[model samples]
Target: MAKVIVYPPTSMILYDLVERMGHKALVVSEAVRNLVTASGIESPPLNVTPEEPKKGLRYAAVDVPSGVRGRMALIGPIIEEAEAAIIVEDPGWLTGCSGCSRTNELVRLLIRTKGIPVLDLSYPTNDDEAKVFVQKIRTFLEGLK
Candidate 1:
């Protein structure tokens, strides 16, 4: 099965679709869920881990800003592991985009460099578009399998 990386990092529709098509979606939502479940307390540490370097580094081991490091760590590994991609860029929804521009750019770069099959799509603005979105993604993923 191909490993499909879905952008927005939290699109449940893409996650479900990937699984339904017998593929895996590398996403951060599962990380969030694990954090919450493991915390068991009212609050949890936000993305801080013992392994988190005091500074951030690029995939090449070149040092970068800590902010960029934090964002990269969220999905860099997934990008490398991905066998394919389903990018749903919905610029109209302010909150639907990545956390910042740097992360967004890096994600696109990682995906592009991999030279894998990809299904690039935009976020649907209406119910009709939503339906089309699902169908499009389904077809793309099934074709991969």
Candidate 2:
């Protein structure tokens, strides 16, 4: 089972999608313990500790980048571990925030330089498209095996 960390905006959507695809999905948030608890999803708040940052971690962001200000608190170790990153497309959100765009650029750079497998699920705008995105994600995950 792959351990997945999903970031916000559409965290729940990604969680549900991963779960539907028959994998264990763990949602990660920052200082939103109560909100995450209320969502009834298994989530842990982002806290940089010294314990290897949880190995075998995979991540999926709700949009091009995750978190407010595009500040990804959990990318460093994951990148070092060469974890798979799934980037969802949200052009409007990316354009709305410069921080998001910068963060996205960083993510792309990390993926390309580190040779981490990246899946761009940018074309699913509707329910049908979302289904296809889920299938694509599952395929990517399978390839990781």
Cα RMSDs of all predictions? 3.3, 8.8
Q: Residues 1-145, candidate 1, lDDT per residue (tens digit)?
A: 8888887666676788899888888886766566557644554356445343333364525455566666576667678888899887764444245566776777887887899997889878889998998899888988886
Lowest summed lDDT window (length 10), candidate 2: 48-57
User: lDDT per model, in order?
Assistant: 0.72, 0.49
What are the models' TM-scores? 0.78, 0.51
Off by over 4 Å in 2: 3-10, 19-73, 91-99
The best candidate by lDDT is 1
Candidate 2, overall lDDT? 0.49
Query: How badly does each model clash, as a count of residue pairs?
Result: 0, 0
Clashing pairs in 1: none
lDDT of 2 by residue, 9-69 (tens): 2256666766676655544332234334455444344332332123212334444333422
Predicted structure with the largest TM-score when compared to the true one? 1
